[model samples]
Target: MTDTFLIGMLVLAAGLFAVGLFGVLARRAVLFQLLSLEVMLSGPSLAFVAAGARHGDPAGQGMFVLVLILAAAEVALGLALYLRMARTADVTDSDSIRDLRH
Candidate 1:
């Protein structure tokens, strides 16, 4: 509830988001990118929980749940595409997947 604690939590949230962003930008593999995207989503989820706790409000938690659902859907879709690419073209790098047409 203290300002210091809240600031620390926000900093941590920012760090998580930054790390995930870096991973997404730096990695070329589809799987790593997907994992990084999850991490990115987690950053906001943590921030929402922390803010909700700090303010004694349930809205933050509700937002976190929504974010969780979004992340899950993204993972499912991403994995499906990755699998399809893997099976059909043996491609894992994003740059190599320029065209979907065969």
Candidate 2:
């Protein structure tokens, strides 16, 4: 039963990762892109936890926590950049952001 549960959790995490990747590739909207990034980061965190549980190891949990911190920092920086760009360009699309170079 435990093995089955672990496999299911891993499969779900993989699916989340795939969806996040697809969203990043296919979405043009900045907000959707950000959301997809979050999903991508979170999927691995969940997988880490599941792996730790399956292996009975504490290091995986620790790694997951570190990854979470990194993800938070990334979100902060990304949001700050988006805010600066939005203020100057008055648009949130990535293509329009190119106007900021000049």
Candidate 3:
């Protein structure tokens, strides 16, 4: 691919990351925040893959795999906590979950 392709990928990745960040910060819903966090994570994965391809290095692919594992674990744990909070505390509101700071 050409430099233009690389730049385009980078721009797309940045856009995705920014949108995800905004969603996380602006939304009060826990599920939406989790999804946004996933989107944010994907942005860097795209950048790393693009860079690895551009440089003909395998490290980028390896890093992406690690990120995928991390994302999976995050989703699993986040959902578990969300469910626990919803069931035990009857809480869906983030502000009400301040007891978690303990």
Candidate closest to the true structure, highest lDDT: 1
The regions of model 3 sitting more than 4 angstroms off are 99-102
Candidate 2 clashes between residue pairs 3 or more apart in a chain or in different chains: none
Candidate 1 vs 3: which has more TM-score: 1
Pairing residues by index, what is the TM-score of model 2?
Answer: 0.88
Q: Per TM-score, what order, best first?
A: 1, 3, 2
Tens-place lDDT per residue, model 3, 1-102, is 999999999999999999999989998889999999999999999999999999899999999999999999999999999999999988786777787678
Q: Go through the candidates in order and give the C-alpha RMSD of each one to the true structure.
A: 1.4, 1.6, 1.8
lDDT of 3 at 55: 89
Ranked by TM-score, the better of candidates 2 and 3 is 3
Among these predictions, the greatest TM-score belongs to: 1
| lDDT pick, better of 1 and 3 | 1
Query: How much lDDT does candidate 2 score?
Result: 0.86
> Per-residue CA lDDT of candidate 1, range 65-91, in tens?
999999999999999999999999998
Return model 2's CA RMSD, one decimal: 1.6
